[model samples]
Target: MSLQDKNIAMLYYGEQPHPAHTGFADAIGADFICCNPRSDGSKIDSPLNEFFNGFSLPDYDIYITEGSRPLYSGIAATIFSDSNLIYLGGDHRLRELSLGGFPNQAQTDTRYLRTRSKILQFLCQHFIDGAIAVSADSATFLQQLFGSPSTVRTAKPYVQRDVFKSLSTLSTDLESKKVAVIASANRGNVGDYKGIDMLVDSWPDVRNHFPDLKLEIVGKGHQAKHENTEGVRVKGYVEDLDTVFESIGLYVQPSRLEVFGVSVIESMVAGVPPLVTETTGASSELKGIEPALVVDPNPESIASGIVQYFDRTVAERENIAKECREYAMSFSPDVRTKIFHEEFKSLIDEIQ
Candidate 1:
C-alpha cells in the first residue's frame, strides 16, 4: 500500500488535545481521537479502566500517542501489540530530574511514579515499534532508560510562530535590562522545577551589576509568592503575549528539568535573546548561536548570565536578538509538522 493509503490515528487521553498531536494528524492525514473521561462517572482505576470511558479504539494501521504513564498510552500498546505503535517520548523519571523539592516534594509518594515509569519502559522495549522525542536528550533517555529497541529520532515540538513572533521591529532601545521568566505553577509549586526561586535569588545579584535591570514573572499562580520580591513584577496570567513580548528585553527559562522549553523559542521568535539552563532542551538552540547565554541551574550561574547579556553593547545585543529570531524560525509548527509527517511515513513504509 502507498504511504498515503495507510490508516493512522493519534490516541490521546486528556481534557484537551495537544497541538503537536493534532498538528501531526493533520499533516499526515490521520484521525485524532480524544480518549477523555466519560460523563458516566467512570473512574480510571487502571489502564484497562481508562479505556472504559465510552471510546472504542478505532481501527488504524498505525497508532500514535504521548509516551509516559502506563494509564495514558499503555492500553493502546497492549491491545495493538502486533501493529505499529509510535510513542512521542518527552517525559523523564522524577528522580532523574531533581532531589526532593517543589512538585517532587519531601513527602510525595514514589511507588506509583516509579511503577508507572517501569510499566512504560516495559511497553517501550516490548510493544512500541517507533519513538520520537521532543529533544535529543529525551531521545537518548527513551533509548537508554526506557529501553526502546527501535531507532529513536529527535523532532522539535510544534510552536506557533506567528502568534509569538515580534509584532514590531526588533530593537535594543526598549529597556534592554528588562527580563521575563514565563512558567506555569498550576500543577503544584513548580518553583523548584522551573527555578523561579533561584531566578528571584539571582535578581538581586543581577541588579548589583545592572541596577536598572527588571524581572517580570509571567504565568498562572506564579506571582503570589514573588509579588514582593525586589525589582520583580509578577504578571499572574497574561491573555495576550504579543504585548508582553513587546516589552521583554531578555527571556529566561531556568527550568531544572525541561524536556523542551517551548517558551524559550517563542521568546526568541519575538526577537528576544534567552538565558536558559544548560540542561534544558532548548539550550541546544541557544548554544549554537551564543553558547555563553546557556547557564547552569543555579542562582550564581543565572545571575552571571543575566549580567553578561546586559553588559553587551546595544548593537551587539541587537545582533544577538536578530540571530535568535532567525534561528527560531526553523522550530515553528509548520516546519515540525512536516518533519513529523516524514518521520511517520518512514515508519509506515518500514512496516509495509
Candidate 2:
C-alpha cells in the first residue's frame, strides 16, 4: 500500500477548534480527535472529519500530537505508547517567548515554577518518536532542546486562506474602523503578552494624526472590563467578522511573542495589510509575501506601524488589497495539505 493509505490520528487542545486543522486532516484523509473535554466529538460527518472527545486511540498507524504539556497531551502519549507517534510543536517553548524572547528575564513568575515546568515538559517531550517543527525558530529550539536535528521536519499549520479570500471580495462599510486586533481576553497574564494592553495604550499616539481613526479590539471577556479609550473600541467575542475585515485598512498583531499568527495570514487574505511582531512565525512568512511592516509589540512601535496606513490613498489601498489576496493564496490549505502528507509519508518510510 502507498504511504498515503496509512491510518493517522491527531490530538490537539481546544474545545471549539479551528476548522483549518480538521481541514488539514480531511485533505490527508486522516481521522481527527480532540483533546478538549467540551468538544462534543463530531456532530456532522461532512466539513469536519471524525472528531472524538475520547482518547481511545485504537488501531491507528501513526498518531501526531500538537504541542506537549497539557494533561490531555500526556494522556495521548500514554494512550499510544508504542505506535508511530510524532509530536508536532508550533511553539513548545512558548513561555520563553514573553518579554522580548527571554522568559528568564521576566520577573512575573517564580524561577522555581518555570524551571520545574521546563524540566517536566522536556521529560515528556524527549520520549516522542519524532518532532515535527512548524517554523524555523521552532526547529532551532527543538534541535537545541533534544541535541538532535535529524528527527525534526517542517510542516506549518497554515491559515485557511480561501475562507478569508472569499470575504476579501465582499462589501463592508468603508467608513468603519480601519485598524483591528482579535485575540481572546481572560488570558490572565498572557493577555498582556498578546499586546492587548500595549495596543490599548497606543491609541492616543495613533489617534493624534487621524482624529476619527478607531482601533477595534475583538475578542471575549475584554471589552467588558476595558473602557473605550479616546480612539480604541473593544467588542466582546465576535462570532462572525466576515464584513468587518472587508473595510480594515491594517491588521496589527503586535503580540509580544507568538509562535505562529494565523490572523496575519487571514487578514492578508482579507486584503488588509498586516503589521506583525518581529518575533512571530507569521512575521517571517509576511516577509516573504510583502514587507508588511514588522514591528516590536511596544506601544511606540505599534503606534508607528498603525500610522503608516493612514497616509495611503484609496487607489493605493485598492491596489495593495489585490496584492494581499494574491500573496495570501500562496500559503493556502491546499499547498500545506500536500506538505503535511509528505511529512507523514517521509516519517513513516523512515521508521517502518
Using lDDT as the measure, which candidate wins? 1
Off by over 4 Å in 1: 39-48, 51-56, 70-73, 93-120, 146-150, 164-175, 185-191
Q: Can you tell me which runs of candidate 2 are displaced by over 4 Å?
A: 14-16, 34-59, 69-81, 90-125, 171-177, 185-190, 289-292, 312-319
Q: Provide the lDDT at 57 for model 1.
A: 57
What's each prediction's clash count? 0, 0
**Best TM-score among the predictions, by candidate number:** 1
Local accuracy by lDDT, each model: 0.70, 0.64
List model 2 lDDT by residue over 247-320, tens digit each: 67777887766667778877876777778877666787667655647877688888887777567676666676
Per-residue lDDT of model 1, residues 10-72, tens digit only: 776655456666676788787766555545646455565654542355566677775444334
Backbone clash tally for model 2?
0
TM-score against native, each model: 0.83, 0.77
RMSD of each: 4.0, 5.9
TM-score of decoy 1: 0.83
